[model samples]
Target chain A: MEQPEELIPKKEVLRLTGISYGQLYRWKRLGLIPEAWFIRRSTFTGQETFFPREKILKRIADILRLKDEYPLEELVRLLSPEVVPTEVAHLDPLALAPIGPEGRELLWKSGEYAFSELVALACGAEAIRRGAKPGEARLLVEVVRRAEEALRAPTDLSALLAEKTVEREGLLLRAPLALVGREPLLLDPECRIKVRLDLEKVVEGVKLALGGEGRG
Target chain B: MGERNVTISGAGRIEGGSYGTVKIAGSGRVVGDLVAEEFKAAGSAKVEGNLKAQRFEAAGAFRCEGNLELEEGEAAGSLKVVGRVRAKELKLAGSAQAKGITGGYLRAGGSLSVEENVEVEIFRLMGAFEIGGLLSADRVEVELEGRARAREIGGEKIVVRAGQRSLGGFLSQALGFLFGQGSHKELVAEVIEGDEIELEATQARLVRGGKIKIGPGCRIERVEYTETLEVAPGAVVKEEVKG
Candidate 1:
């Protein structure tokens, strides 16, 4: 792709922003602007950095506007992708993508549900449709939700559900947990249930499945 | 009261204390020193005092005014630390500016600018780095795409090579020339010392190693090797010594 004329050099960015190099780097560290936005290019003199002109100008303006109202730490969260606790009952069922009507209904029936919980419920609904028992599927969803909560990040239901097996009292359940990198953790010692799921994979999956829903 | 997890989802400030996991999803500030098993910040965060954690990860902007001690540190946004940093693994996919860093493994895919010394067991850079002080590592590998500089480097095994410029790079350079874009593609260092060393597209003052291989686009003031040495076609060495 051809270079856009809107790319402003680092020196120019500083001059226009009326900020020093120290302030620029400090803001970058504080997450006022993303590091990827700092574009490096080979110059006649040496390697110099550049930034998208309008984007940088606007970002700096926003930072200045909110600097006093919120501390730097709080500003980072305000500027980042919002993680709102969503209630399934409050949302329109038709707007959820990839999830079928049955799955939507199942999620709506559940009380308050976070976005990750909704994804987990969808996975459970899919498993039940695939001939798994209803009770076992519900257990799977609960387990996936717990795992997501433990990870403290959005969890992927598809990948987590791919190899998950629900074991019943003294009987071999459906599918055994696929422990890729980590060891097995005894979630319920009395129930003799052990579940191993790749936390990183689950997080990545949730990000992919949810698309833009959880980003904001 | 001890909390298992503490999450700040809005604009909030946390007085430094001990916690199992500290997560900041929105803008937050830490007033005093903090101790946590895991510290994760996705939004902007600032720590006024020191921080000790097993794992410290930030995807957005983070700034630590005091010292930071972490077993594993990962940053995808920008991180600025005014005090010393000690970590087992430090991974950067964004930009990091630190006063001094001591780690076991340092991997960077973005830019790193350190004002003081950097000592690591392994140092790998796929992006750009500038170190004002001495850099000592057991293993050092660098594929330079942007630019890299260090006052001095000491390692057991060291390899430095130029990264391939993408098609976008060529286009930008062409446009840059016409539109006044700066184009500098070279690695600069004062001195390099290692047991085994390989260099390409680097400009340095002195290099001393047991076994040395100088590849293309290398300009060196002096080279001293104990065992073996190989010089490529496009390398320029002002002085060479064998012992």
Candidate 2:
């Protein structure tokens, strides 16, 4: 089983990121930060807030980097994973930075692609970037496309490809399976995890890529 | 569409629909949802359904069964909303109650009770409040006349003070019944965080800020500060850490 993701305490996040409580709350109110990211747990000192380590750090970095250029309201549209850019429809999926040339193979019948479709294509493209086979990437895209409902609670969600070996009549057979669910996605003893992708990050990337194009 | 004006001078009952100006002088009850440009009521008025108006003014007892959406609203005696309230500007004089409130400038003179969050640009209260969830604002100023409890309070600049003893009977008797009878005015919260903070007569588990001043009659379990920390003589803090 993969190690559960690290959590950074609220105080530590403020210290490490050099952001004050007011700024954090303001961003939260503005929807630049998702409510699901604020994980409240009862620590020794009453109730304390925590955030996923890598995701919070990356989100804060992106916000701090772009806050100067774009208005905070616009930043919410560009960065928030919870915001699905449904109004976006593009003729070519390869134009987005997150998809790029690697996305060429994920195309099915591409006159115009909706926002979620582009996100699915971007997921497959990202899988390919991580050295997965084209077929495996396609598998991930299919699973993620059906996972539209999962985006409502994007935090701690994972997409994975597992390979299982079966012995039948003294013959060995391999089966590959793709699935998506909340994290700590466990597989049985015979299955081996081939690829794991944090869907939150991929969703953010797709939003950022397509969002700028729409706004600009 | 420009709907006709509706006015109930005395006791009346009306079906809820679109209107221009709705005024209820006496006891009034609406059956369904109301969409109006201006809603005005005096004495006891009740809306069984949702209310959406550009301007809303209520006096005496007013109650809405569904949500309240207004551009600007002011209530003098009592206002109660069963569902959430979204307004650009909300001013409550006597008492107000809601499930949740999200607005711009919110000023309450008397008791303000919210089941959940009260997030606004500016929140200023003169009497008592009990917020089950977080009370967050750009600027939060509370002049406490009675006991107040919020799970968490966060803002840019938060200043809370104990008001001089006035309105002793109505506030004390009403709020005292809710939070148990306590002679001294106090604010209780689990966590209080802000950039610039100063508090008095407050009890909190954790107080965090950039510049924090623990004023008189305060008991805090832990205090974390980045810039400046000052603890008054009467205040008691279990732990103080400057980071």
Candidate 3:
């Protein structure tokens, strides 16, 4: 549902963030906040700027948290998902528990995996070990696999891991889904255990293991 | 050479080459160059290499890291191209950000940002538009609903005016007003050169044309016209030079 309260005026954002106009504009130029977010509105006084309240606030907080640790350019690279090469052999086996022989084989067969794929594999393996049927685990893996292949940049999987429900043999099963984009996957109701993985955390872990400083 | 359709429904990656038709309903990635007769994506797609397509359509987010060449393209959601884009017809209703765009016809209704030059035969815009470099077109029409900016605009015929509200537009604006979501309407340009030009609600540093009509809500520092120059009551022009 759309709400009027979703937008906040530029004045309000500045007041809340305690930042000046120059800082806001500089950040905008540096690609910290998207130009689309700077909405122009006709007010009684004149034209004013507005932004998506939640998104801007979160971005501002992220920039503040990481500004000291990294430069603006580095922050852009970290915040923005850019596709990069990753080797499957670098993944920690301990973290990929419950990965069935088939899933492991798939990883071993492929020389490299996208970061999103790594997250998906780990989630699917964990789900299978926690009581998901083989088919259900495969579906989970498929979701992440597609995301890894489709996305050109580093993807934020957290948005994709929404809780979903499935019906099988007249029984309703809550299937916690992990996704990267808009891919749809079917899950079997035979999966009984709750599947939960912090994909963001996993991405950070993968990045750190790959010698990149983890996100702030 | 043979007609083929490849659809990726889940997470998938294509090494990138040539295909008859490539469709993505889920997440997809292309690592290298892609040549497709038709390309459609309903989900998100990322291409790390150049993309050449006869027709391209995307309803979800689409990103291309390298150059893009298409006969026709339509985007109803977000699109970002890091390199140059060359198309015959490009229509956008959601939002687009491109490094540069050269097309035969360009129509945008939502938001657009071009980091470099935009050269088109016909350019039409209704919502927010920003160009960091020159915009050259045979014909340009903009019904401003929000802020529009360009470094320079050159065309055979250029028209910039306030948005005209139809029945559906009035209803939407009424709802937006009730919901406190109304947008401003303004156009800003550093320089404008055209054969014939009409401007309203525009702020420009210099305007040079063969025939110029400065309508209401216009502020210009200087104007140079060859044949005729008409200034409406609400317009402000500091200096006028006839050549």
Q: What is the C-alpha lDDT of each candidate?
A: 0.68, 0.88, 0.72
Best by TM-score: 2
The candidate with the higher TM-score, 1 or 3, is 3
Model 1 chain B poorest 10 in a row by lDDT: B174-183
Isolated chain B TM-score per model: 0.91, 0.93, 0.93
Per-model i-RMS: 12.9, 0.8, 13.8
Candidate 3 fnat reads 0.00
Candidate 3 chain A weakest lDDT stretch, 10 residues: A152-161
For model 2, give the interface RMSD: 0.8
In model 3, what lDDT does residue A207 have? Answer: 42
lDDT of 2 by residue, B1-243 (tens): 767998998899989999999999999999999999999999999999999999999999999999999999999888999999999999998889999999889998878999999988899998789999999998999998788899999989999998775556776565555435555589999999999999999999999999999999899999999999999998999999998
lDDT digits (tens) for residues A1-216 of candidate 3: 113337898757866987544356446644566655667787763445689787688778878887898887777655533424454443443333333343563353334455666666666666666666656666677776666654443323332334566778999877555445421233344433245443444444444344342331
Deviation from native of the Cα of residue A183 in model 2, angstroms: 2.1
- Misplaced by over 4 Å in model 1 are A1-216, B165-182
Local accuracy of candidate 2 as per-residue lDDT tens digits, A1-216: 677778999999999999988889888877788888889998777889999888889999999999998898889888888877777778978989989999899898858887777778888898789887899889988988888888656778888877889999999998878898997777898898888888888788888887677777
DockQ for all candidate structures vs. native: 0.01, 0.66, 0.01
Listed in order, each prediction's TM-score against the native is 0.50, 0.90, 0.51
